[model samples]
Target chain A: MELLEEKIRKEGQVKGEGILKVDSFLNHQLDVALFEEMGKAFAKRFAGEGVNKILTIESSGIAIATSTARYFDYCPVVFGKKYVSLNLDQEIYSSDVYSYTKQQAYKIMVSKKYLDKDDRILIIDDFLANGKAVEALIDMVNQAGATLVGVGIAIEKGFQDGGALLREQGIALESLAIVDAMSEEEGVIFRAQSEKK
Target chain B: MELLEEKIRKEGQVKGEGILKVDSFLNHQLDVALFEEMGKAFAKRFAGEGVNKILTIESSGIAIATSTARYFDYCPVVFGKKYVSLNLDQEIYSSDVYSYTKQQAYKIMVSKKYLDKDDRILIIDDFLANGKAVEALIDMVNQAGATLVGVGIAIEKGFQDGGALLREQGIALESLAIVDAMSEEEGVIFRAQSEKK
Candidate 1:
């Protein structure tokens, strides 16, 4: 977690309107070594939860989720696909997510074959801004009749309502780095290490 | 390679129009253990190429590229993003690719900051069907003046022209499993191991 916070502080760019550009090592460009360490942290946090599956929403979350899956005894990582509108196939579990960034709603789906009642799911993502994506992922787990073990995130915008909202629902969410506040001039202000969930 | 081939034969669905869906392991529901094995195989094949960076396109390719990056001494993995019409920002390199599956063309862009002349890149992708995506990625690499060491594909549809064309160009292409032919009835018929490029 310290390593991730350090990496973010070093390379992450803080832009206007709460935009944190981490293309260097987080999103567009991936750092698998850091992902491995983050994976180990997730594994430790959700240690005995019997997590058989790791769920995330693409396109940014795939790398982190896949790397985290290795620590969970190589559990299958199922990512929800983004579609403007889905065909509502009966063989899949689908959920609607409202993207505040795009100011539009979209559907995220997972094949029913991958998630089911017997599975314990750990929802993972790169960023949890408003919690829309994580909520949709949790909805899919409910649809599959699966157990919601917890959620793991690489970065959580702490100033946003997402982290507070999920914690209110009693979800065991763990974010490697929580940006309490960030500004173009002052840079990123991370939440104290003693304060993370 | 044998492990991957076996997974495809067992779980891969043979859909119409030459679609071999191995979503259970390769793309949708990713198996990190399998990906790690794949990374090892790719490392062995592209050994001593000084592959310092792993390049891939987003969604399907990110997970594999992230896993593969581990074998490359935990190098940076940069993925091209798919956009309908990119803004052509001065900070990015963009390439056009026509997707036969969707019958539409899209632009894939990579940040100019991540790719440059000194980088040795190994492109990794989930599938190489028509090779349009890979070709577009190569175009971006060329635009950035980067060195392309080779390509590592999880599955190559040998019946398609992609593999043949790439090899014809004298590219160091290594496909873990090459499906020479396949059908719902006959399943998948892979090319002999010795026959691969």
Candidate 2:
């Protein structure tokens, strides 16, 4: 977490309207070494929760989920594809996600073949803002009759409602770096993990 | 390679027309252990190429790219973003790719900050069919003035023109499993690497 916070302090750019750009290392351009560290941290936090699978959304979440999968005994990582392809199976568990950034609503789907009642699923993603995407993934898990183990996120926008809502629900959510506040003129302000709860 | 071939032969579903769905282990639901094997195979094939960076597209390609980066001494993995967001920087190298499966054309863009002329990049992807996506990625590399050390593909549809075209262009293209022919009735037939050229 220290390494991630340091990296964010060093490279993260704050745009107007509470946007933090970490494309240089986290999102668009990825640092797998850092991701491995994050993965280890997640593994340590959720050590014995019976996590048999890691679930994530398409695009940004795939890399982080894949990195985290190795620490969980190489459990299978099932990502919800955003785009509907001709080859996608007809039988799928899907939920709608509204992206605040893109200002659009899209469906995230996972093939029913991947998840079931016997599986214990851990949801992972790169960023957590409004928590819509994570909520959708949790819905998919619920629809499959699977147990929701926990949620792991690389960075959480604490100023947003998502993190607070999940905590209120008593979800075991671990965010490596939590940005409590940000602005183009003022830079990012992070919340101490101890102080967050 | 044997493990990958075995996986394809066992779990890969050949649909009608030219579709082979391996979502059980490859794309949608990922097996990191298998990906580690794939990363090792790719490292073995592209050894001594001085690959400092792994380039790929978002969604499916990010996992393989992240896995491959570790084998290359934790090289940075930069993935091209398909959907444009307000946060995306204006300065980027963009290319148009026509997806045969989706039946649509989309733009793939890489931030100009990540790639440079001195970087040695190895392009990694999940599948190579018509080669339009890879070709667009190659074009982005060319735009960056970076050196493409090689291209590593998990599966290549040999029946398609993509694999043949990359080979014809004298590109160092290594596909772990090349399906020469496939159908719902006939199943999948892979081309022996020795017989491919």
Best by lDDT: 2
User: What TM-score would every model get versus the actual structure?
Assistant: 0.96, 0.98
The runs of at least 3 residues in candidate 2 whose Cα sits more than 4 Å from the true structure, single-residue gaps closed, are none
* Residue lDDT tens for model 1, B1-197: 89999999899988777888887888788989999999999999999999999999978899999989888999999999886322223478999998776678888999898998999999999999999999999999999899999999999999999999999999999999999999988999999998885
Report the first chain's TM-score for all candidates.
Answer: 0.95, 0.98
Best by TM-score: 2
Candidate 1's error at B17, in angstroms?
Answer: 1.2
Instruction: Find the number of clashing residue pairs for candidate 1.
Output: 0
Candidate DockQ scores, in order: 0.62, 0.92
Q: Model 1: how large is the Cα RMSD against the reference?
A: 2.0
Worst 10 residues of 1 chain B by lDDT: B83-92
Model 2 lDDT per residue over B1-197, tens place: 68898999899998877889999998889989999999999999999989999999987889999998999999999999997888899899999999988899999999899989999989999999999999999999999999998899999999899988998999999899999888887788888868855
